[model samples]
Target: MRIERSNWEQRTLGEFFDLQMGKTPSRKDLSLWEDGDTPWVSISDMKESRYISDTKEHLPYQTIAECRIPIIPVGTVIMSFKLTIGKTCIVSKPLTTNEAIMAFYPKKGIEVNSSFLAYALSALKWKGNRAVKGVTINKKTISEKNFSLPPIGLQDNIAAELDAIQEVIDGYKDQIADLDALAQSIFLETFGDPISNPKGWKTELISKFGRIVTGNTPSRAISDYYNSQDIEWIKTDNIVKDLLTPTTAYEYLSFEGAKKGRIVKSGSILICCIAGSLQSIGRCCLTDRSLAFNQQINAIECDVNHIPLFVYCLIKASQQLLIDTASTGMKHILSKSDLSSICLPVPPLELQQQFANKIASIEQQKDLLRQQLADAEMLMAERMQYYFS
Candidate 1:
């Protein structure tokens, strides 16, 4: 499927497509959003899916006219060019998108393959300004971005080849999702609902399970504290809800820095206790090694009576409670006292062990699926580079 691109026309996106950016109606006006059936696309809606069939939110036709946002036609390619750049998809139906997304229509008398355009746009290495949310690419820069356009027949062939690869990737992702779901189901079947306590298991404050330690960042003013990468430093970003093990940190601290921050021992549970986004506040993961962490997380070193994985899963199941308990303000924060006071069902030690065993098996299966997913993604990345880079 790899073809020489030397003879293909080197062209800017604007030359072949008319660019249109989307707009959001004032969020304060419930009239614009309620009782509406028209799909309103946002960056979140474009995640994972190549063809957008439905969106998370919808607006009324009246709002479309009132907001003066263009109704992108079916099969038109759209790319998110602002924060979280380079996500691209084809709209399966007429829809309106938020300001971050740009719709691309074939210019007058110009024919372009929508699938090829989406793939090409997704492959773009965007350079954008960094802000609080992330990176943002301006419209002018996006219009000037370049790509080589092959003949219509060749574009179709290339799209087909990439689509086949994507199908394989998606299949692996579905299997991984299935294993995660299986774990959740097993947990519920074994322990009953944690919230309702259908099995009448004894409940206690989270503090009863372990020594709770809120993490702290080593002083940045001390040059020696951060000059060398001597130990892994866990941040809120390093914790992932899907994985029991914390990911490698993007940063590290010196041995002197480790003294300033609290060292969470291996096999402890770490939870994000502070974040700008409320959904991020309750994210939890387990520590596989001793490391220093930032103040946004709280670590729990479980007592002899508790299994660390069980406590981690228990907190995950109580995520809604954490969010509900957090103070609503510019930033959501779960204070140490607030986190410790939350009640969790404590089942018999033998039952906890059984649940742990089943989950471990599920985790092993997920690990293999993740390895396969990574390999498939690498192949996809290589193909994309060869075709579009």
Candidate 2:
């Protein structure tokens, strides 16, 4: 695809840089790892970051030297080519990575800007991701991807412009995180940590605070059960974090289908009881409208003494705890009985309402910040399209 034509030349990625994949020592070679200070990077360390400064595993310098593992210098661009394909980041510190990741550096005498190159790769990722397994990109395909190039000065200018927009977006993200942290701080201060119960508050099972309800799927053999706008049918994928908007409940069920599944009203708490992803097993969301869901999920109707918002926060905070109890294999699952048995600090209803009020106010601020970040991202995308589509 031709991104730009005016005052810019098209250069293949391989022409501008050399692609070298990382390496790993043998599993039996205990002497290679745990023996040094060199950072051994992998996909886990990639983490949606633009720049990677540390790694999950580190190799001893002796291992890199003995195994002839080439370490890349700071500022080198890195991309994962297998398992998690298309993840890319730049390094601020020297590190060594595994074979699933490839490091690209400007060719000798080439002055390609690092930030511009990183953003350029981001654009390529959308197009480069394919269905193939194992090796996602071969030398031929990597060499075939072209990037638009202006002179070094122009590249620097574009990179700076993009970086500024990204900085603003990052600032908003940090603010949002701070707001969330504030709520957690309040919870800890008021009710104490649920694990320790330092506040000496009463502790009780989740079931004591709410009634648990699991959903069921309408028979697929009946065509009339689906694709009707009259009802909202939720699934494990429909809930993310604490938000449960209508867009996520894309599958609509007819009135008949609603009969087969558990239809819940607004303010009900939804949790993923079954999912392939263990990380998603315990995620919960509060519904704002009546909804029906399949058997993969369960709903909670908290007692009058408990606030749904407070229950949502407490449940969200205990995600890892829930995941631990989920039976693992092909699909992770937490039976309704197991979910009800999970414990929490049962602070008084008045105190819980105070926390809910604070959360509602904080959410309003976060919503505004999110909208601003969205606008900045749109403008950034437009500028990127102009410079390097």
Candidate 3:
């Protein structure tokens, strides 16, 4: 990660580029959005990607002129500076963004490279006011932040090197995603679709195989409850996609807090019954260790008759049903009653074990890939700090 720092010059971002804060169009004007064609960028669209080619929302061409939104040209570097501070990307086409994002393009007579600028911005240590969701930086504060600027040729070289590392990271991610698909494929091949019960397996309510317990949050006002990290406290955010176990948690509980909350032992299945969106209603993962969780999750401790892993897969395969049920409710949530009554295919114990064995083999390979991904990400962090911090 060593670099020639003697030749690099420190420059404020505002000094090298013309920066413009983006603005949202008036939402009430139906006429302005009638013929949507122009891309509108947002923080969510920049999730873990180096380039933004398209956006989740679009505006009609006329809306841009009518709303007085600045048209950001292709190759312009954009960074989110408000809630999700410092997520940077190079725009692949003409687009406009909401107020939280700021666009930076080289000023006239400057030879700045968009990819290099984007990489620098992404790696920059953003200083701002922190909130529950993310950091917030005003346009003036962000514009004044300084970064090391190497010669134009060095910039190109650095960007190319980083791009190579990024390709490796993306490759590992693709392999992990493929393994997940393979796991789902193995489940379907072994037992058909759980929702359709195509194999004509016996179907029973989820509660028949286990006792269901809904988690609860320990009172926040009681300082003694959180005085020590004696136990792991699980939350919906900890239940990552495709991962059987939860990731490291930011919040922990003391012995006192653990008593206030329900603890589900290892091998029990945890599902997100309450969430902000229908898509998250049925997301489930198996616990690798005993842990206390919040009300957003429901835990099912399977008995000898059913395998927890098998049940996890079955519930996962029937996710659409959970989504539909959540949609029917007044809010995007599934109650304990709702979860307990949901029926799933009941394959024979031997068959369930066979499916679990196949998934275990697939998981072993995924673990190796995940370790490689972690190593690549660590290298990326170190290199970014060396070049930009």
Q: Which candidate leads the pack in lDDT? A: 1
Which one is best on TM-score? 1
Candidates, ranked, lDDT: 1, 3, 2
Residue-by-residue lDDT tens digits, candidate 1, 103-211 = 9988787667888889988888888888788878888988898867888878898899899999999999999888878888888888877888899999999999989
State candidate 2's TM-score: 0.90
- List the candidate 3 regions with Cα displacement exceeding 4 Å: 1-3, 129-135, 219-230, 251-257, 327-331
- Candidate 2 wrong stretches, greater than 4 Å: 1-4, 125-135, 242-247
Count of backbone clashes, every candidate in sequence: 0, 1, 0
Q: Candidate 1 local accuracy as lDDT?
A: 0.87
| Global lDDT of each candidate | 0.87, 0.82, 0.86
Question: Candidate 3, after superposition: displacement of residue 270 in Å?
Answer: 0.6
TM-score of each: 0.92, 0.90, 0.91
Q: Could you tell me how far off, in angstroms, the CA of residue 56 lies in candidate 3 after the best superposition?
A: 1.1
Residue by residue across 352-380, what tens digits does model 3's lDDT show?
Answer: 99889888898899999999999999998
For residue 50, what is the lDDT in candidate 1? 89
- The positional error of residue 315 in candidate 2, measured at the CA in angstroms, is 1.4
Worst lDDT run of 10 residues, candidate 3, spans 323-332
